[model samples]
Target: MAQAKTTLRTTAAAKAASKAPTNATADKLVGTLRDTMVSLVRRDGPDLSARQLAVFLTCYLQEEGHTVRGLAAELNVSKPAITRALDRLGELDLARRKVDPLDRRSVLVQRTLKGAAYLREIRSIMGETSTVAKKETETRVVRATRRAA
Candidate 1:
């Protein structure tokens, strides 16, 4: 009997090792993500999955208006998938869907005040993460210098 072949894939760390200038820098980037996520979860806020967050970010960050079809094409996801994400976002008051005046058949995705506030909060958390990482790196450098003396 012939056995099926299993494909092996290289890990993100392995790929980063080849492209990143330093392991410390790559580690810091990952640490920043972890810390930011932790901060977000600890707050009184909605916890969104990666896909939902991507959809949210795309709507807020991009100035151009979005539609279910447009977002699906832009994010390389299915229209139904985008609709589901939007449903969650609407429940959170982060986004709203509206009937396009020009095209009644299409639904436009709109940004909400709550969504803007959430984005601001995210920015603050990421900034804090960067600051903490910088302080850690500086402390390491100082320790290394002291040990050399």
Candidate 2:
């Protein structure tokens, strides 16, 4: 009975693996991210650090009303680290701080036009990179199948 249960579990796992999405999609996403980072550094030349990139993406991707304490907690980092990232972002004109009128002690992280434009450009780069990566992957697969047969 135990042997039968183990066989059944193994078969189920195999079926789940077969039904999983192709690795090509994941590869394309990774390629797109890498290309986007390179483009940001080469073309735009802001040369942001990893933390800065994380903070930037989170702010743009998420809704407004982001606070230092909230961001620090969400990112699992220290408040000073968040503050440093915010400082760098402010210097690059990607983000700014605003005193929350409701809470004088809290500061709000506000988005800038430059930051929005940067995000749009990154989106375009990622789209283009994904398209190219998908085409390459398809071509490679076709060649491999042809050689196999």
Model 2, span 69-139: residue lDDT tens: 99999999999999999999999999999999999999899999999988898899888877888888789
Give the poorly placed runs of model 2, Cα more than 4 Å off.
Answer: 1-16, 19-24
Q: Identify the candidate with maximal lDDT.
A: 1
In order, what lDDT does every prediction score? 0.92, 0.89
Best prediction by TM-score: 2
TM-score of each: 0.82, 0.84
Worst 10 residues of 2 by lDDT: 19-28
Residues 28-127 of candidate 1 have per-residue lDDT tens digits of: 8899999998998888889998889999999999999999999999999999999999999999999999999999999999999999999999999999
Q: What is the lDDT of residue 129 in candidate 2?
A: 78
What overall lDDT, based on C-alpha atoms, would model 1 receive against the true structure? 0.92
